[model samples]
Target: MTRLRWCLLAIATLLASVLAVPPASAAQDPAPILDPIPDDPAPSGLGLVLQEVARLPKSEPSAPPTDPRLVRWNRINHVGELPDGSGRLYVPDLNGKLYFLDKKTRTPSVYLDVKATFDPDFFSAAGLGQGFGFVAFHPDFKRNGKFYTAHVEAGNALTTKTPDLTPQPKTGFHGVIDEWTATDPKAGTFSGTHREILRIGFSGRIHNVQQIDFNPNARRGDADYGKLYLAVGDGGNGNVGDNGGDPQNLAVPQGKILRIDPSGTNSANGKYGIPADNPFAGQAGKVGEIYAYGMRDPHRFSWDTGGSHRMFLAHIGEHEIESIHQIDAGSNLGWSEREGAFTFRKDDRCHLYPLPADDAKYGYDYPVAAYDHDPPANWDCASDTGHAISGGYVYRGKLPALRGKYLFTDIVDGRLFYTNEREMKQDPTGQKRAQIYQLAAYDTAGNPVTMKQLAGDNRVDLRYGSDAKGELYLLAKANGKIWKIVGTKQYAGCKPGPKRVSHVAAAKNWAPVTPSKWRFPGREVILAEEGVQRPGPRRPFEYAVLKSGPVFASARIDAEVRLDTPVEISNRDVIIVFGYRDDTHFYYAHLSSDNTIYPHNGIFVVNGADRLRIDQQWNANRSHGAPPAITDEKWHGVRVTHCAGTGEIAVYVDGGARPVMTALDTTFGSGRVGFGSFDNIGRLRDLTVRGTPAE
Candidate 1:
């Protein structure tokens, strides 16, 4: 199997094995299965209606602030801000280059090239896994220049007379935590000194250790300055023996958050000393480093601003949940015992040991916020569609607009919500009294605004950070865009210009594409098109096609079209009349720049005819045969007509009736048309795209 496939399989197998084992605690009564919420009903009316409060006025600072420039990196899994006011973004790319972003410039530069810094054989021998963790700067980083990282390291072979069945060779440490020192403390960059702090072995990648965060509130000048809090996921393959959720276990460090002082001592394996205050430091068999235990996939977590009595952990779950737990020493989070307030295995027969009724609450830690699979509010966890929760810090910054709010987001849903400590405490019983408002839209001035509807919703995991003063920043996962929530009051009520409808004709120089004409709700737009005479070398090309609606569409072209290069018809529609024509077919539909196809099922052309026809019996399909013949070498007029009720599609080529098909559903809805090579090459000309909303 491919490496990626192997990794995925390993992860799946691990999860299965971990969860398949019966929980230690089994209940006498049958487990309570919460009733699923109705799909169409409005959200439960239990919470405070935030809409009833007066809307906060948009900030009106004199000079509008500039948009924060986004830093680009390969597979940025997490980000953390230094206490010294600088930001460090960690990318666990396959190649293992650690990147640092300068908060001021929003530019990314390599902080540490693991390949160059570590012994090359380390990875070759250990069999490096995907870079899946984080790098944390010491609390007193200004003077200490110490930072720590958690990552996968190959482990030594487990020598048994009988061979193991798992794919992992008898060799390799699945995960390791390392501490390094910067060469120069005064320098603004990270290319200074280096050191290996510690290494912990794991079985595989899944449930590997994720991040290490320092207690921001820890004593600054004390020996604890470089002491760290490490969040380790249940070590790969969810084996109960990994001791993932059991805080009492001593043989394994799989599920625990470890506390250590990097400068303290040297052990048989490496450097770093365990803090005496660590929960289990003096215990006989337990790893002295563990601070707390009982967590699933602790992908990301953070200490609140000002660091007093608050920490957030985003725990990944299997079915029905993802949670944010508040940290406390010796906390038993009930991983195999429970998943986010719900019992996973409740039958007494399923377990060898029974846990207390309040297992998760027995220890010092508890989940501050937890949600189930319900929609319109909590993330859709039951579907297992959401992957991980990306924990974020509470916004305790200089920006008056977002101060005093706890901001956290899910990596899978891209939803941002804020809650007060009081509100979070009240959500334990699956009942909430506070409204979690969606951060719907941002005004042009960059102020947050509640929209009539949510837009641009996608699975863009948002990474969070804060500056020295604790101002909040967001890193969008989809495009690596960075947005700073700033106060702005300058609003120019400018209307958009007219739409330039065709690619065959040259775009009028500097013409404005009006918001109304372009059919987008936004205030600005620019229209441009390019046509190539000769086919370029086969390569991926990114293009933006504008449609007069809410969606953007894109596509790739491997071959030619209309007697040019042979175009492969990957996407097609026979129902909509006016769409792009590839070599094999005319789309007869509007496509968004993001590759969303919309069918305008109103118009159609008689099959094999040179006459335009409006037919209600048209059907849309991907395999509708070759596009109608084009008379000219370049530029052909195409029209699509759709009938919503009849589910018909008609296509006209150069105003001549051509093909008609019946759509399985309504073919047309009023929306703009966007066409171009999504990630590959193709050409366009004479594209007159228009739309009217479905009435």
Candidate 2:
């Protein structure tokens, strides 16, 4: 018998119990689907309950590094709990220190330093994927003092050590995986014996070794017990080089999820064993270590502690899509061949096309839940806009709002995103994957905030961490800060009311914060002058809220506005106010000339502090087309409709049937409606307000 057929036969009984995947059939791609990922619709009343955790001091590099990723506030990535029940948490910095955090006190102390103790030649000076990337504790760590880590080393080290797998001829760096046994597992600082277990050479630094983990759900007697899964990237082949051959190749470990028994010995390395039931364990000409192949950068992966216990890996895409694939034994996540559910045309890197008619012949796997980098972001495929996807857990925590949801985020923009766990399903045809959604975020003071706002940096460089109980935490490299997900907070109340009431055009009934700055020009109310005229009391030129007419819990404002200022201005905007509780809080639709800037052309909420954006279609388009809400000097018909119970707010421009902007927020309910401009003179005419009066 052939070696491949013999190996398959030997593991057939074992495979039935350990792995089950659908057999490949011609019916897989009857109707290929190729469509831009849908924009997240409706604000989830649910938002993250973020409580401040410890902040690490900025780590200045010993020498200046030219690469942008190396010049960060701090380079911390992974936040993990030690396998022991001591409640100790360990966070690693790419600059070389492993910090041990105290759960009770919420303090951090250095637990280990790679450069000082392990290897001085640790190369963390440059490269996005270089340095201490990930760490995982063995399930038996409490008893064995065993844990594993993946770190980067300089290419010069290639002279002394031999790599287990070297896919490329010319190597740029090495991603090393090591096994360490601590003298005292419960100790604060690490004092241990370490040995190199596996080393993989990469031709490029980016997307080298992104994550290393164990099946946290697998118990001692389970079939997956001691298997270590390494998310090895394509060595920058399939992504930047636009060459998919290496990842699609089965002979090498690059661009593959490799699974091996860390404690067993039977493989070529003699340090790890290939599980007997591994789909390709002893298959001919194929690497036994590969669990699944064809990936770009499998940034992170996790197993749902409860439910189906299926493995999910968040993949950072080369162009448009950022995806999370449901991994199965012998599965191939088509990378250069496919990006998410769409067929990837490597030569045409900017666009994604439909899968080919014979897609089933390749037996590729598509993401169960995926999202794109545009519409919600308006990012170009070539640049560093909203591209990375940091994987998060299928929350099995007690937080009612976050539970049963797979929470994730954009690594660069710090936008929090999630997909319903119940909705993630693998479809042979690329038609019905889960729709991704955005959850609102508020601080301890109950004011809405974005990661960019909290970190004071545009690039949050985000990552996720979890406790033994499955609760998650947000870690950022931008400000070296960590925030724990404490509970849930809905910014607005969902009680709908206020019977139909309408009022129109009565100058005497209008109430503006600065009556002097506004003028009643016949039938039109003109913010005829800027706030600069009044120096005394110094009324902020922020937004004009007219609390006259009818107060509402649910409200609608239809108005015609004309900016008297010339079109030369880049930041001029008109604001429509609703859900106004008082001067301190309310919601507003900011229609501006520029949509690319973060603060302009969107819906926002002022919850006592500064205004926070709540709009999903913040920048729906750039050079590829969609226009900003209002960019001309002429009059535009605008409408703002808010539903109190559902916290749905949509703003339409120029009588368009669909909202130019949309946001979900419950920060305030049942308040007055009004109009004004942020900067420059604007007049609101033909104004009408209709709503049920606030109870």
Candidate 3:
């Protein structure tokens, strides 16, 4: 077998063994292990949770002479919050118009008409991906009335004389970013002064300048407060062989995340000022306008306010992987060379190339999260592969269950998937597949709606939007409809008991329930595993249970433990078992060695007689962090927190604020807190538990 096949096979074997339930008692029948992968996506048709709050009003053309496709493709692209706190959302369409939807009145009205003067025939031949790309209300829009937009306009459509607006030889298209000032902030419509900030002369209609967003929440004096970040795709004519050189070449503006001072004039061209802190602003031989290069078509990107102002980029891939990159200034995400942590060559577009064993050496930054087009048939993911990636926001809504999860989607399939941002950050190398779960959305009538259903079996072209309150919204481009995401909880399959509080901070509070030597000082509790042979099936999950009398519906547990033995003694781990509904139903974090040879480390869930690996780390998109040298005879701290209402479990190691591993499941309600490993030798100390009791 090829090396890739061998690696896949080993991963499959390790996952299969991890899910095997060892015999607890000889009298129990042989329990079956669940399939680690599903052939197709399975839907939970609970209810139609998407309600149609608004739709774009019909447009009257100045002239009735244009192609008919514009009616379908010229649909709504995004919904962004206005700076004014009137609870209004600006929905930008592909036809160069912006519609404002009022949250209170549940109505829509024209906010700005970009095509009011441009001829209708000029828009008829516009590229499929052309039109008004996106809009950004200035951070000080309420005060300055200044905002920017990125759009595709005919050459000479605007009276801008910038170098970027130079006419393209083939398409005569110019991608433009214009700054507009609203005469009145509270006016129902916009009649503003337009200034061409920057423009790019493009070879084709697609892959034009797309987004113009300022950090909405950046404080007045913050470093990133007034800077506008622009994302431009590589203007490559793919019909010919001109595929994406701009992303890798840094001297130009295309295929890059650019940072500029829209209101300042410190640039070489003086149209806009390049941010002094940009990654390449002062670097010799690099364009000062470039922030970070190497992207094919960054179809959409968003600044995470809930995070530390980190920008997440979603790039449309070439023939294979669609990627979501966590961008840091000066980062060089390899495109035309690397796609989603793997090698990509324009000459060998049809063949798959292995990722370099050491990718960082090449100075190429990979996505914290990425998915391939070809995944094994059995892996239980949204899909083993997908077409284009639609960028989304980090859920900061009131739902305690959805917070901290980044929700992104696939355009071809319209399948919504999410991964914990904390988990992706831990696997920065992109070696670990980011765990992805398909979101089962429903219509307002409680009818289950699949992406295909919403797309009318056509290209879904799924796009995401956020309201003034940060609640997420979904836009169906094919249908020209807006959807508000609503649900009481996520994956509500398990029952949550009454709220109860429990805490066990003293060392003597934990009671040993298995073969063990327990020692307790005032500050710590140590349990040394005895060389006792487990008398049952070879189930790795059948750990020796050490319980604390704290029943929990949701809680956090912190403990410090040291591995006394070397990692060579088989699949040994320092496990933190929680949500213990019974001896059979519980969850555990298997903190194992950084054993490169065996990829058996991750979180697992036990439901009745069956055990499954629910954590994102074990499958095709495993986000499990690389194992650390835990067997070095050192004390490593472990913290685990679970919210029953959200069915979210986060595992933190070494007192890090972010979780190294995360999983979501509402299988069991309340259970005792326990600590143990699967037939492993370890030392546990400083055990403490704090949480709501499961009644």
Q: Give the best candidate by lDDT.
A: 2
Which scores greater on TM-score, model 1 or model 2?
Answer: 2
Residue 604's lDDT within candidate 3 is 74
Task: List residue ranges in candidate 3 displaced over 4 A.
Answer: 1-48, 58-74, 120-126, 155-162, 165-172, 237-244, 375-386, 426-429, 454-457, 490-695
**lDDT, candidates in the order shown:** 0.45, 0.77, 0.66
Q: Which is the better candidate, 2 or 3, if ranked by lDDT? A: 2
Error of 2 at 217 (Å): 1.2
Worst 10 residues of 2 by lDDT: 531-540
Write down the TM-score of every candidate.
Answer: 0.54, 0.73, 0.62
TM-score of 2: 0.73
For residues 484-601, could you state the per-residue lDDT of candidate 1 as single tens digits?
A: 5554221111112222233322333111122212111132121222222223322112223343333212211111122222234333211122332222122333221112122222
Model 1 Cα RMSD, 1 decimal: 20.4
Q: What is the lDDT of residue 560 in candidate 3?
A: 85
Per-residue lDDT over 1-695 for candidate 2, one digit per residue giving the tens place of the 0 to 100 score: 69999899879977885556554553353333323674443345567878988898678543578867667888889787888898888898887788989979879999888756546557777777778878888999999999888988874586777678745657767888989999999888899899888998888768888888889888889999878999999888655453447788888888999998889889897987889888888988888899998898889999999988989999998767888889999888887688887887656756777777778887788888877766334445566654589988999989887778899988998988888888999987766788676677778866667889887788889888999999899989888999999978653433334444334445675677677777775777788776443333222364456645457877777889887777886678778888877766777887778766766778888777777778766543432212477778888999888877556776778887446666767778678776766667788878766666766
Best candidate according to TM-score: 2
